[model samples]
Target: MMAMVTMVAFALEGYVNFVGMTLIERSANDKESAAASWCDYERKGTRDKVKDLRRMTGAEIDWNKRPYATIKELNELRNMFAHPKPQKPKVREWEAVGTDAEFRKQLRDYRPEYEERLTWEFCTRAYDDVEAIWQHLLEVAKINPFDALSGGSQGFELLAWVDENGRETRA
Candidate 1:
């Protein structure tokens, strides 16, 4: 579950960087300037990077809404897992149970709030949030989501044609 959450977060980060760089290349006057601009952009926080992309592409994403809000939570969850600190578990008082012949004492260890966040539902939701954000950006950029490298199950394919003259061209 931790792995899924972390991967989803990292994938979202990579996707934003990819989209941001593409936008920079398209808008900048020169390759050198684009490269330098990208260097500065890469240093910004994840939220800032997303905001930059939204501004560049005219995407009106409400930061307080579903998928967007999920992004913030996902980042926090990723950070918690990435830089985990040792924590003392809350141990409950021992309780006696059963008859004297089978008597046993049990103690419960309380889980931390961060640990509680690692649920299967959360992992699935995080994955869905990433897909939603990716699709939204792709729509604003006027790029076909189906042609995207991460586009679902259709996979990716390249085709080329060769004429009788032996010259090859991509279809």
Candidate 2:
């Protein structure tokens, strides 16, 4: 039972960090995207379309137009999970494993959130939220040109180094 509890806690932390890492990487893409669009508008020379694009995009999207702030926050959250955060404790690190009262206090002080045994339902919800953010990042990165052509669901796709023409090039 203790092992199960420990596993679940670590899983939760991992999922959170996974989502956070994606978000952080996405922030870079956001900047890239804004740069792409500047060329788009510059070439198209359509005032109405440019106005429409601004309207369609979020307010946070500045002249370059990307959610850099949100991405930065997500990266920080990921780093917090990736390192041994003294502020949070894993289930296996319970103070009961030690005889000293100091250890017990340390455990409780760190993982104060787990007032009860962490449940699947709780973990599932957290995972779901992480998934949503990840999906959004994929959409923004435009990982799949086929999806762009088809106008289908913009799921996450990775791009390798590309030739000047934007075709996927060999490493």
Candidate 3:
């Protein structure tokens, strides 16, 4: 569970930073300012990036399906796991195991908003939300994320992949 949350957090960071950089590069500013500005904004948290993306795309979107809401929920769960305020005696970490009811009861005093256990199902939904936001931002930016790795467009490799067996693969 910790691993999932950690990975999700990092993945969202990388994605949001990439999007920020892409947006800066697309702007009329010179290359140096664009690069520097992207780095500057990239220091912000993932939630901030989500808000930025929403603002950037809000004019085009109908507000029918609010992607940031899901992202915010996922962010809350991530925070709950990452920095749990444990109320139970000597319970040092978030309960990565046990039934939802048991976990809730254990955290009842600590985090009352943890209505559901951070199960694989919850992670799956979070992952889907992340993907949805990624797609939406890519569409709004008119940027094909794959293009960054495909055509030497960015002048160097920006992405790589690893198979289940741990073999490295270029994008």
Candidate 4:
């Protein structure tokens, strides 16, 4: 579950960067300037990058809405696991009654929220949110998601060659 959540977060970041870079490359007049702009854009944090991509593509995303909120929460979980810090143990109190006596107990340990987020439900939801965001961005950018994923719209061709006779052949 943790691995899935982490991968989904990474996938979202990668998708945003890929789309932003493609847009920049297409719109810029100079390749060098486009490369430099991409470098500056890539330095931004994940949330900021998402916002920048949304603005660039003219897509509206409500941060407080379903898929967006879920993705944000997933990113938070990923960040927590990625950059962990020592957390003070939480104190939990419990009461017990035996046949002979009643006892009170205190336990100190990590909070349940961390474990709670590692559930299958959360992981599945994170995956769904990533798909939703990916589709939304692709739609707004007017790029077919299937083509993008299959490398069909990447603006370059492979298996093409020019013979010594200067005749070009394409696969």
Scored by TM-score, the top model is 4
List lDDT for all candidates, in order: 0.83, 0.42, 0.68, 0.80
For model 2, residues 1-171, the per-residue Cα lDDT tens digits are 233334434443443333333333444457676556444444531223323333443322332322222323233433444453666344463335566887768655664433343455544443454445334433544344343234565676665889899988765
**Model 3: per-residue lDDT, tens digit, 1-171?**
657855776667677777777777777379788768777687777877756666755535433355555556666777777788864445357645888888877766563346445678777766776777777778887777676463545555657788899887866
Clash list (residue pairs), candidate 2: none
Q: What is the TM-score of each candidate against the true structure?
A: 0.74, 0.25, 0.59, 0.75
The worst-scoring run of ten residues by lDDT in candidate 1 lies at 101-110
Q: How far does residue 161 in candidate 1 sit from its true spot (Å)? A: 19
Q: What's the lDDT for residue 151 in model 1?
A: 40
Best by lDDT: 1
lDDT of 1: 0.83
lDDT of 4 by residue, 52-138 (tens): 888887888999986888866887889889998777655655554563323322222334667866889888888888889888888
Segments in model 1 whose C-alpha atoms lie over 4 Å from true places: 85-108, 150-171
Kindly indicate the candidate among 2 and 4 with the higher TM-score: 4
Compared with the true structure, what per-residue lDDT tens digits does model 1 show for residues 1-171? 888899999999988887887789888999999999999999997889999988898889998887988888899989888988786766656556776544432222346777687788989988998989988888887766555666457654666787898788657
Residue 48 lDDT in candidate 1: 94
In model 4, where is the ten-residue run with the lowest total lDDT?
A: 100-109
Q: Kindly provide the TM-score of model 4 when superposed on the true structure, using C-alpha atoms.
A: 0.75
